[model samples]
Each structure stands twice: as C-alpha cells, then as structure tokens.
Target: MPEPHQLAADADRAAVVTRLDESLADGRLTLAEYEDRSTRAHGARTYGELAELTTDLPRPAAPATPAAPGPSPVARAVYGGAWHGAWGNDLRAAWTSWLVTGVIVTGIWLVSMLGSGDLVYPWPVWVVGPWGVVLLARTLGERRSRGDRQLPA
Candidate 1:
C-alpha cells in the first residue's frame, strides 16, 4: 500500500520479496535483517511512512530511506504540531509543550493578579491559560517535527 510512485518504482511488490529471499539464501541478509526489512516494507503505506517501516532495520552504510522534511511554521502553529514524529514523538513533544506552557500560563495569572485588580474577571486565567497551552503545543510541535530536540546541549 505504498505511494503510487513507490508501488510503480518497485511496482512489482513481489519482486522485492523475491530479491529479499534471494539475498537471504545467498547469506547477503540474515534472518533477523530480513524480518526487519520485511516488516518495514509491509508496514509502510506511503513513500514517507519509511521511518516507522524501517525503524528496526539494522543500520546500513547509508540509510535506505529518509523522512520527509515535514510541515512548515505556519502549518505547525495552527495544527498544534500534531503532524510529526516517527512514532509518538509528536505526542510527547506536545505534552512537553503543554507543561512549559502551563508554567508560563501560571505566571501570567500570578502577574495579572499582582499587577491589576486582584484576580479580576476582565483578564481571566482561563483565557490566558488555554491560549498559552495551545501556543506552546504548536510551537513545540513544529520544533520537534524539525528535529530540533536533537540539538546538543
């Protein structure tokens, strides 16, 4: 169920299986390696589904496949950064964002309460808290999608 081009490029799905079988027979690939690649090949439903498809594949001299660059800034900002990560990376990143945003939101509430009319309705924590959480989730989602989390300390 890979993409049109993937299916066409190796259109003969059977061919890849045959090649794998041949390779395994010749000791070019081990049973473990074959299973890993086979799982990925079968699990992938698109050209870009390559990441998970090959997650367990043994490291090669060069990656047999790569991930898509992913969504742009604007896209991420609006979508809450959900369209990202190989497996659950996006979800985890979103939660991290929520945590950070929660702190920011609490600060906003405290500041608003301290600066203006004590805990007033006009400037509500409900409004700020949810907004801050959403913004943080979106921002982190984009950063995670771009693999920024991989940066060195």
Candidate 2:
C-alpha cells in the first residue's frame, strides 16, 4: 500500500468522490458538505487529504462491475493484499494473439502476391478475421458475465 502522503492518481480521486456522492445520497452528508468535500477531493494531490474527507463515513459497497486493475475484496480477504490486475492480463494475451496473427497473415499475403505477380484474393483475411471475431465474442461474453459489458480495448 502507498503512504497516505504519496500523490494520488485519477482513479484514487475518483473513488473518494464516489464515496462522497454515496454519503450525500444516504443523507449522511448534506448537499453543501458533499459539494465542499467533492471540490476538495478533485483538488487533492495526496491520499492523506482524500482520506481525511471520508474518515467518518462507512466504506462504500463494492461495485457490481469488475473494477479497474487494483485492490479487490476477494484478494484482500484471501491473500490480504491488493490485486495486481491478473484478470486484465487475459485481454493483453488476446491482443498479443491479434498482433502475432495479423503479422503472419500479412506476410503470407505478401508472399502470395509476390509469387503470383498479381493481387489475388486477400486470403489472409480468411485466416485472421474469424479468429478475431471469435476472440471478440469470447471477451464480450466474459465481460458481460462479470457485469462489465463495456467495450473491450
């Protein structure tokens, strides 16, 4: 875990603001208080400052959607440590596959054209397109299952 005085990232600031919003909705904080704290949260440069704003409030509930690469409840419960984005690594592997397959397909197409001295059918698309589609479908399904149906990168 980072020291509270360390610089806060956008995600950290966003999380603190979200807590303020929830506190407002629950009547734990007045609109004036929420606005004041939210403004300070946006301007805050360190985790220590953000923590001061929420120290009195209960921790917010976990969002249903899978969060961005960071802490996870299950990881903390089991391993007592923050997550290291192991789940997101799958997408990286998928992208790597796309890059490798695209290069191979393009190379094949170039070789075919050079040998035949004519632009024949772009046969590479046949090899790569369906594979890409399958990967996309699989990624979407997995994300949907996790309640994170946003577009994959």
Number of colliding residue pairs in each model: 1, 0
Worst 10 residues of 1 by lDDT: 51-60
Global lDDT of each model?
0.57, 0.77
Instruction: For candidate 2, write residues 1-153 as lDDT tens digits.
Output: 679989999999999899898899999999999999999999999989999999999976677997555434564466333122335555546757887989988998899899999988888888889988987776665545655322322
Q: Point out where model 1 deviates above 4 Å.
A: 1-89, 122-153
Which is the leading candidate under TM-score? 2
lDDT of 1 by residue, 1-153 (tens): 555445323434344555566667778778998887666666555555444433343434553675656556654567544555445355546566667766776677778878996655544456456766776666565666765443211
lDDT comparing candidate 1 with the true structure = 0.57
Residue 137, model 2: lDDT of: 73
Cα shift from native, residue 111, model 1 (Å): 1.2
Q: What's the TM-score of every candidate structure? A: 0.26, 0.40
lDDT measured at residue 13 in model 1 versus the true structure, 0 to 100: 39
- Candidate 2 similarity to native, TM-score: 0.40
